[model samples]
Target: MNKILLSVLLIFCGTSVFSQDTLLTILEEELEREFKVLSKAEVPVYYMDYRVEDETALTITSSFGSLMDESNARMRVLQPTLRVGNYKLDNTRELANYYGGGYFGANQAQYLPINNNSKAIKQVLWRVTDFAYNNAKERFQEVKNSDIKNEIDDFSKEKPTKYYEPPALGSLDESYWKNTAKKLSAQFLGDSKIISGTVTISGSFSRKYFVSSEGASVVQNFNFIQVFVSGEVVNEDGEIASLYNSYTASNEKGLPSFDTLMAETKSLVENLQKLKEAPFAEPYTGPAILHPRVSAVFFHEIFGHRIEGHRLKSEQDGQTFKEKVGSQILPDFISIYSDPTLKNVEGIELSGNYKVDDQGIESRRVEIVKNGKLQNFLMSRSPIEQFSNSNGHGRSQIGADPVARQSNLIIETTSNISDDKLRKQLIEECKKQNKPYGYYFEDVTGGFTQTSRYATNAFNIMPTLVYRVYADGRPDELVKGVDLIGTPLAMFAEIMQAGKSIDVFNGICGAESGNIPVSAVAPAILVRRIETQKKPIVDIKAEEPILASPLLNKKN
Candidate 1:
C-alpha cells in the first residue's frame, strides 16, 4: 500500500551524505538546541519530541516484459511535537488549524539534510519547533472555548525507554533489484488472454532516531524487501478485474526463490483468466466458509479497527465494543490479540513487528479479547477510562501524528477443526439455511470498514477469488463479483467453526494517522450466515484491444 518512489523535490541545500554522519548524533544535538530556546517562552514548552527517519531505498518496475521505471535515492523524514499546555488541556485534540488539518502538530514533509552544516540543520529544527508550539497554544485556547464531557485525560504518563537498534539486514545494490524485476515481469509475456502484467520490487534500509523532553531516547533500524506481481483483465461485461501476488521479507535471503516468484506470477495470470469467464454472482446472504487468508482480512477490517482506544473517545466513532468489555463479543471459543514485538511466527518474518513505537514506548502485547469476551483496547499514550497506560500500539507514518493502531493481529480459537471438517460444517449450514450453495472466499485483494456513527457501522471486504460450494457435495464452481459485507457484531456471532492451519495477510493499513504496515494471522472460519453484495456496474464499453500488443503480430 505504501508507494515509496524516490522524491524529486528541489533541494535547497546539498543532499545528506548519510554514511558519513550518525543520525543519533544529529538528533541529540538539535533536540538540545531547540529545547533550550523553547524553554524560555511565555507559555513554556511542557513537552517536546523529535523523530527522524534516515532511509535509503530502491524501486524497480516492469510492464509487459519490458522495463517501465527504476529509481534509487535516500529520504530523511522529520517529525517534531511540542506540547505547550498541561497534559489534560494540551495543545492537541483541538479544532482544525488554518490548514483544515489536526491542530496537534504540523507534519513536515521534508526537512534539512544531514550533510548540511550544523547551523543549517539547527535552523530547520528551530522553525519546526516553533510551528509545533504555536499550534499547541491555539489548540489549548480552543479547548477552553469548547464544552464536552471528557472523562479521560488528554495524555497518559510519559514513558521512559532507551533502545539502540541493530544494523539492518545487509543492503543489496541496484543491480539485484533490477534483474529480479525483469525475470518476474517476463512471466506474463506470451499469455494470450492476459491483458496487462506488471512486476515491482522495492527494498529499503532505514534507521529511526527519537528523543523527548521527558527523558526518552531511542534508536531503531529495520530493512525490508517486497516483490509485488499483478495482472489485469477486462471481462465481457465491461468490468475491470485484477489479481495480486506479493512476498515480503526483512532481507534478500528471506525472500522466496526466483522459481517460486515465477510460479506465483503464473498462478496470478491463470486466476485472472479464470475470473474473466466466471459467472457474476447474485447478491446473497447465507452460510459461507472463509479460507484462512480471507479470514485474516475479515477479522482485520470488521473487528481490529473498532477496539483502538482513541476511537472510544471520539463522538464520531461507533464505539461498538466500548460498553461490551465484560461481555462476549464472539463465539465462546474465540479470542483475539495484537502484538508488535513478535518478529516472526513459524519462520515467517512479520512486517508489523517494531522494537519501539513512534512515541518512544516499547512494543508490547495487548489482549483485546480473551475467550470470546471483550477485554481491552489497543492503546497509545492517549488513554481511555479504566485504561490509563500505553500498550505500545501508538503508531504513525513518519510525518503524521501517532494514534492507536493494530500491529500483528492474531486470531486464536480453541475449537479448531481441520479444513475438511470446516467445509463440511459450511455445507451443513447451507442446507439448514435452505440455500442452494455457500461461498468459499479463497483470496481477497483488500477490504475497508466504517466504524463511525455518521456512516453504517459495517465493512466490505473485496474478494478476487471466490467459489460456490453446493449443498449436495458437488464440485465447487468459480464465481465472480461479490463483496463480503456485514455488520461487525452480527458477523462475529455467526462464526461457528475454525480450521487447524493458520494463514497470514500482510499490508499497510491506513487510518486517521496514515498508512502503517500491519499483519493478520488467522485460521479459516465457517460462518453459519454471511452476507454479500453485487459489485457496482462499470462504464467501460466492451471492445477489441485498441492496439493489440504487437507481440509477434498475433491478433485476438
Candidate 2:
C-alpha cells in the first residue's frame, strides 16, 4: 500500500498494540477488501475512499474574575464515500431543476474507537462502506433517471497521490491556561460602563488517515491554539456596543506570552469603552479606505466565494465570474491567488495551510487572477467546463463531502503606496466627489455573502471599528453602527488604490462543505465610491440587569 512512515520510533495514544502508522495500514487493507467485492456488482463501484480524523480538543473560559468552565473532549469520525457509475456520470451528479441544479447529501459519519485497535477500526469501516455503497447505487439510479442532461463530467480524473507527515501530539498545561484566562478576563472588572467581559483559550489537535481505491493514501496532522477576548458596554442613549479581538497560532509555543495577552485584553476593553460613547452613523455613499485586515475580509466574502469551482457548476449559483473569465474583473493593477502551501505570511502562521486536501490530493498554489483578469477558479476533484482537474482546493470538516473552498486568499497590486498616501488619496477622492468627509474601516468581526441565484448576489461586511476622515483636515472621528454593503461586481470596480503594508485575517469559513479554517491577506485599499448602512441598535436600558455584580457590590 501507499504509505510514508514518519519515523521508526513507535507512537502510542491509547491502550492498543498498534502504532499510529499501523492505523493507516489497517485502513488500506479494509478498502482493498471492500472494493474487490463491490467491483463485481452489476452497477459497480467506480470510486471509493475513506477519511478518518482523530480529534482531541480542550476549552478554558473565564468571565468577570471567575472561572466559567474548563473541559476536554476527544472523538474519532469516519466518512466513507463510494461513487457508482463512471466519472462522466456518477451518483454524486446534481439534478437540474427549474430553479437550478444543486444537491447536498450527508454521509452520516460513523464513530470509531480512539485506540489504534485494528480489529475495532475495521469493523466500523466495514459497516459504513457497505452502507455508503448501497446509497451510491440508489443515487446513481436517480441520476440516470433525471430528465435534464448535461455534458459536464460528474467527477474529474486525478492522479493518485501518496504523501505523509508525522503526527504532532498536543501538550497542554491546564493550570497555566486556566490562570491566564482568569487574569485576562479580570481586565474589565470594576469598570461600571462594561456590561459583559469574557476571555477564552482553546487548543485542538487532529490526526487524519485517508485511503482510496485508486492507490491514494495520506496521513497528516494539524493543531490550533487560540486566545479570544471580548467586551460589551452601554452608552447613555441606551445603545449597547460590543467588540472582540483574537490571536491564533498553530502550536502552543507560537501562542502569545502572558504580557502580550494582558496588553491585548486591556486594549480590547479600552476600545469597547470608546465604541460605547461613539456616535451612531447614518447611511452614506462616498469614498472610503479599508484597513488591510478589513480589505482581506472584504475580498474573502465578496470575491473569493464566487470563484469556488463547484459554484460555477451549480445552476442555482449566480455564476458571477463563470462567463467573466478572460475578462477584467478587478483593476488591472490588482491580482488575486490562493495558496494552501503558504504556512505563514512573514511570521504569522496561517490556519488554512495544509499538506494535502481531504481528497488525498497534494496541495498546491492556484493563481486565480492575473493582471486584473479572471484566470481560474479554486478547484476540487469535481470537474467543471475547461478545468478538468483538482488543484488541491477540495476541503471539508470532519463529516462532510469535500468541496472547492478558499485557503490563503492573497490580494496583491502592482501599484502600491504607503498608508499615508492611501489616506490622502481617500480625502482627495472624497473632495472630488463633493463630499464633506469619507470613512475608514479599521477592523471587522466577520461577514457573509449570498452566491445563490435565488438571492440578491450581495455582500455585507460588518465592521466593528470605523472612523470618519474629514476632508477639512480635522481629526478623524470615531463612529459606530456602520456596515459595509455592496454587490460583488459593482464593488470590485470601485477600487482606487492599495497600500504597501500587507495584513492577514485568519478565521473560519462555513459553506456547503462545512466550517474549515481559512485566511486572507491583502493591503489596505481605497475605494472610489462605496455604500454603508446603519446596524440595528440594542436598547440597553430594556436589557440592563437590575442589580450590580456581586464582586463589585462587595465592600472593600
Candidate 3:
C-alpha cells in the first residue's frame, strides 16, 4: 500500500481543483455523519462502511481488418453497507431488507457521477445511509423473533491497516490499439474455411477507496491490458469449433512485438484449418491427459469454486467442501494455494494481483491445501464454521458487493514428471483400461460449474482442440465434439501424476456478485479416469453451400 499524496486537481472523481485531497475528505465527512446518527438510533447499528470505485476504460475492436466499436468512458459509484445486530443475524442475510425497496433497492450501489460539488456527493450519501439504516433496523427485529441460531457469525471483526495512494491518470492512445486490432484480424481474410474472425484490444485503469466506521481506510489502483484474437469454422459434422489466443500485459511495454503476434496468429489459423476436417469423437469414459493451460482451467472450475466460504452458509449451494476440510480431498502429491499479491511469475504478469481487497484487508498468500488435505476456505468478511476473518479474497466488479472469489490460484505437486513421461503414462493407463487410445486436451476456451443444490454437482469443460493418442504407437489424430466432464469429488481422486513445468491462465470469473478478474496457474496432469460427453450438434447438414469456398467444398 502506498501513501496518499494530495494533488492540485481532481480530474476523475470530481470536476474541481479543490477536491484534490487524496485523503478522501468528502467520504470521511459523510461517513462520520451517518455513523454518529445511525449508531445511536432506536435499533442501534453496529457498523457502517462506504466504498467507491473510479474506473476508466477503453476498448477497440475490429473484424476482418475493419473497426467495429470503440469505447472510452469513466464512471464512479458510492456504496454503503450498514449493519445491525452483533454478529449472528445482520441486515446482510435478511430477506425483508431486499424486498421492501426504496429508490434503487435496500442494497445497491449509489451513483455519484456528478461529484463536482461536495453537497451533491453528501446528499446522495445521506439518502443511501438512511435507507440502509432503516433496512438494518427492521431486519434485526425479525432476527430477534426467529428461534434458529447461526453456526457462524454474520460478520467478521475488523482488521484494519491504513493505505492510500493517488492513482495515475494514464493517457490512452486509441488509434494505436485500433490499428493493432485491424492487423490481427486481417490474418484470417484469406482463409476459406474460417467463418468468422475478430480481435479486441482492451485497456483499463481503476482505483478503489474504502472507509468504514470501524476505522478501516484504503486506496489502491490497477492497470490491465489484453489483446484477444479469435476465429472459428464448422467441423465435418456441422459442429462449431474455434481457436482463441490472448496476450496480456501490465502495460504496452509488456505486450508482444507485432512480429511475435503474427506468428501466433499463423498458428491459430493452422489449428482451425485442421479442425475443419478432423473426425468427430464418440462418447468415452477412460484416461486422459490435460495440458497445462487446460489443467489450470479444469482445477479452477471443478475445485476452486467449491471452496469459497460463503457457499457453506447459503442453503441453495452444494457445499461440496464444507464437510471435507480435514480430509484428504485430492491425491497425496498435490497441494494448492492462491495469492493476489504476486504480480508476475517467470516474466508473465498475473491478472489477479492486488494490494488490498475491496473490504480494506491487505492481500496475502493463503494456503488452501496441504499434502492433499483441505486446509482453509477462501473467505470474505462473511465467516463460516472455524474461519471467522477475511484473508483478503473479497472481490467484485465496480458496482457489485464484495464476495469471496479466486485470485492467483497455483497448484503444487511433490512428484513431478516430464511431459513425454506423462503422455506415456496416460497410454499405459488406457491399455490397462482396455481402451485403444486416450484423449489429449490441447486448449480450452472456458468452462462452467454448477454448485447449487438443485443442479447436479458436476462440471463441464469445453475443449477447443483434442487429439487421440493411440496405445499401439500410431500418430495422434485430431478429433472434435467432446466435453470433459465429471463429479468434483471423483475427479480429484483420479489424479495420476503432474508435469514438471507450470503455466498460467488469466481471465474474468462471474458469480452471484459479479465478474471479477482472476488467474489460475498449474502444471499438466494425467488423470487415470474421467469421462467425456458428445456435443449436441445439429444432425442435419446444410442444404446448399452459398459459397462452396474451398474450405467448405471438401464435402463435395
- Give the residue spans of candidate 3 off by over 4 A: 1-23, 94-106, 538-556
Off by over 4 Å in 1: 1-21, 94-104, 107-109, 552-556
The TM-score values for the models, in the order shown, are 0.92, 0.94, 0.90
The C-alpha RMSD in Å for every predicted model, in order, reads: 6.5, 4.3, 5.5
For candidate 2, lDDT tens digit of each residue in 451-470? Answer: 99998999999999999999
Point out the higher-scoring one by lDDT: 1 or 3: 3
Residue-by-residue lDDT tens digits, candidate 3, 1-556: 1212221211243323223653367887889888897788777788877888777889999987799999988878888888777766676663323332111233558788544578888888898888777876776676677554455677777556557666575545687778878988988876655777899888887777888887776767777888999997765445667889997877888888888988998889889888889888999988999998899999999999998778777766789998887899988889999999999878888998988888777788888999999988888888777777888888877666687889999999987899999988999998999999999998898899999877899999999899999999999999988899899999988998999988888888888767888899999999988899997667664333466555335566
Cα error, residue 435 of model 3, in Å, equals: 1.0
* Ten contiguous residues with the weakest lDDT in model 1: 1-10
What ordering of candidates by TM-score runs from best to worst?
Answer: 2, 1, 3
How many Å off is the CA of 280 in candidate 2? Answer: 0.6
Best by TM-score: 2
Q: Clashing residue pairs, candidate 2?
A: none
The lDDT per prediction is: 0.80, 0.86, 0.80
Best-first order by lDDT: 2, 3, 1
